[model samples]
Target: MAGPSVLLPLRSSPFRRYLLGQLVSVPCSWAQVVALAWVVVELAPAAMGWVVALQFLPSLLLGPWFGAIADRYDRRWLLMAAEAGLGLTALAYAAVSLTGGLTLPVVCLLSALWGVINALDTPARRALVPMLVPPAQAPGAAALSGTVMLIGMTAGSGLGALMVTQVGVTATFTLNAASFLADVALLATIRVGPSPRLARAPRQIRDGFRYLWHTPRLRTPLLALSVVATFAFTFQVSVPIFMRASFDGGASLIGTAFTVSMAGSLVGTLVAAARGLPGRHTVARANLVMATAMIVTAAAPTVLVALISLTVAGVAWSFLLMSVIALLQTAEPAMMGRVMSLFALVLLGGTALGGPIASALAAAAGVRAPFALGALAAAVAVAIAWPGAVRPADRSSRHVTTADAG
Candidate 1:
């Protein structure tokens, strides 16, 4: 059967089912993230920095291993497990909160579990996109997914804040738990396309390291992106502190800032969706825009200025992230699951480390210092990735020499 049109993957078979599942799933996931962050802020005002840092610790620690599993297993079942885990994790958080025994330590421990589950879920869910849509429609499918996620994030963050304010954290946590349950039910019935047989798999775990190391197309972009992500994601953590200290804002205000930025991301995703075909210079252009926006963000003194800068940053964030995924898809479809798993590791793992370090620097230097440093890193990463972007060569061109291997 012919695949759905590039513009409307949502109008067809298996992809339509998956898209429906995602519509429900994305908002739930985003809601949980916002709620979890707010819960940490409430439980440990003294160590809000630490709580934020711990939230991403699992992605850093378990992402590579999960990637290895993604390469070696059926993605559908893996996603199901991940969805189920998220639901149960939500329940665990609810139990702690409902019992009126919620503590920072317990929340941290639970967040760690959520992190591991997230690490597994992210790559499989992302890499599975191509399976649902045709190769020609991959870019469109990606943009569709991005738009849904951004909208969901915007809605989820905004609603979570309101839920927390109007009702209680208990209600928010219960609702988050329900979202995961809903996602699980949606995923159970969709028909996933072909995945590589792993029964007699190559030592893909070890080869994955080798594959990444030897591939200039993959390694160069990945490493460069990691550098940029470390800085950009640091900004993600820094926003809360900046809002509280610089603007004297509270949780609701912080949520508003995130919601606004997410709006920008939504716009950017739509633009990308309209483009349809993946462009060669997408990453380079996105990075340049990102760097410019970050510089503006660092210098902005007023809340309005910061919000505008953040909106720009959000746009660049969406484009560059979608571009990065496009690059991965262009490289090797068979290896996508594995590569994406590792991609999640670096992206999120870097965020975990970046958050704590950025917070510490902000503490030692000033709130604006992290943004300054982040902008500089983004600039450099863009510069490094520039040459490769122009060449548009194969990622696997580089080879390991005996001397280097030794």
Candidate 2:
């Protein structure tokens, strides 16, 4: 903040402490992600897609169910439990690798376990923000949450890649496991009021769909977003293979790619923010940029060209995703949570749907094929969105971040 007046959210001790925990934990998570891919590639390159699928499957299958559990329980405590579980999961992952007992099957099991822990954690984590602060400062907390993750990405990927090369993937896993303990400890120190027992009716899910189907404005953009997500979100699975196949690069190279790509994402996000509220055709425009950039990235002749294009893709992705969430916020206030939930499923959980397919494309067609697939999917998104609504963005929606959406 430029001044004390601008940092109201930080005044809340609970929220501040929580953010500190995230600053420590999120980087380790990214480190684990970078190392995990390399291990899978080394063990069974063909099965990387399966690993991707297992890693995200729980989010697709259990998100709503887990969200309900968060509503019914004390979110802070639930988050603590989930974090502890994740730490243990990471430890188990490290142990297997250290003992030379890591196999494809073992990796898949741990990946699935990690996914389950994340699914259990997300709703609680999202809800805990508001609980940590007053409503007036909730937006600030939400905005900062994304920033924390971006900072983590910037630090973690470069360091993780270096660790993969210098020390090995085993150290990355161990550090990540250790990082989770910090979060657990920090979570224990923050106190919040007891949550009321909230019961969710089963029909709410059906009703949310019914509303989306009837609302043309929300319906069309979501459809387009769905198409784009099915391809674009598998960057980790695709890009590592692209590095290996195209440039004979390894995990450290993958980390470098992620670092540059995320830096470009930060630049893109700043550009979008500088423009203020998303203008007319924002979503359509974002898709067009995204598609074009991904195609270029897929076809680049050299590592430098591909890395530049990857950065551009990252920029487009921020604009594309943030705008969609903003559009979702324009829905009726009473149904906002449900609508957001729908967006989360399509945007984040669809990783399960896309990961396996993209991996198979990489394994069979060529490493460049997955990014090319994204380009095609993004082109479809452009087509679907171009003739649709003007994509009116909610003013409040401007603060949304890709991390929060995830």
Candidate 3:
């Protein structure tokens, strides 16, 4: 079998162009998150949890609607609109804060709106990748996308922290808003094939959900992913509180932790891009690695130690996420938009349902408990994948490799 380097040339220029667009926008989103969270802490200290919750609320409420939109509309325009909306929302946030009239309710509304934009943007952005990249290089493209996202996140988080401390909250928000304009420019430059044409069938949304539900392999991976994300999503959501309560650290520490984890993500994506996992077995192996990392992360006693643990977790995270993406993309190229919409819905559900559970658990039982339980959930999910790991016909060495990979 050939390695990823051998397959590198398969992707097109448009793939890289789109990737660059994401590189600009994703980090912008993360920077705004850092800014928003910090502002909430400063302005409405007691209701920070609610503010964070508002950020993800749109994903939960309108995820299916967004998925339908991804299938129904031209993805390029959808992505551009989402990026611009998010940028404008950040400006709104800045305007309120600069005027000394910022309110928690207003922040919540803006955050929810941001969520709506994300809902529309995420599926379109994801669905476009396979169309741009060749089938052989899809895994590499996914890894590259993950790498860009993490890199952006690291820079944005770190920069937002510095801006808040040195400049002010308003400056950080303003820069975040600016990042959207830059994203729009980059997106405008990328020319992709026309999006798939959908039929004007009477029950299109119902058909999308039905198609997803009936596909066993798709259903299985999505279910497993949901279970895993339920716990894993907590890392981003509750980490700020963890920094504040456990280490008595501030935004700088939060930024550093994210940066460190993103470094791990870079490592993971590079490895995935260089080597590539060829089969379902490889994906399973990656899931085991992810499960172990999460367990270790949950068990860490100190913030620095936890950060190190998160680095390992990040590697596992990227590998598993990419593998799942490759599997789904390979399975349904024609309906990539619909398949990814389902993927987006599952992710949204996991984050939305899990965020509050994680928050309440962290608030009540301490930060480590929810993390530990999350790790346990991951382990169990991996265990569930064991039965489908390999086929009976592959009872030889090839079968063994397949089983291990799964």
Clash count for candidate 2 is 0
For residues 1-406, write the lDDT of model 1, one tens digit per residue. Answer: 1223445667547777767777776666666666666776556533555665566677777776777677667887888899889888888888898998888888878877877788899878877777787666666777778788888888877887687678877777777778777777777777777676555455766666676666666676677678877776565568877777788877687777788788888887777777654455667777788888888888888999999998888888887776666566654665676678777877887787787777787888877778888788878877877777633344354233323422
Best by lDDT: 2
Return the clash pairs for model 1, or none.
217-395
TM-score of each: 0.90, 0.87, 0.88
Clashing pairs in 3: 281-405, 281-406, 282-405, 284-406
Positional deviation of residue 67's Cα in model 1 after best superposition, in angstroms: 1.9
Candidate 2: regions farther than 4 A off:
1-8, 131-140, 192-197, 211-221, 272-277, 326-341, 390-406
Evaluate all candidate structures by whole-model CA lDDT and list the values in order: 0.73, 0.76, 0.69
Clashes of 3: 4
Worst 10 residues of 3 by lDDT: 394-403
After superposition, the stretches of candidate 3 with alpha carbons farther than 4 Å from their true spots are 1-11, 43-49, 282-284, 390-406
Instruction: Give the clashing pairs for model 2.
Output: none
Top candidate when judged by TM-score against the true structure: 1
lDDT per residue for candidate 2 within 167-265, as digits (tens), equals 988898999999999999999999877664466666655555676666666778888888888887578778887888899998878898888887776
Model 1 misplacement above 4 A: 1-6, 200-202, 390-406
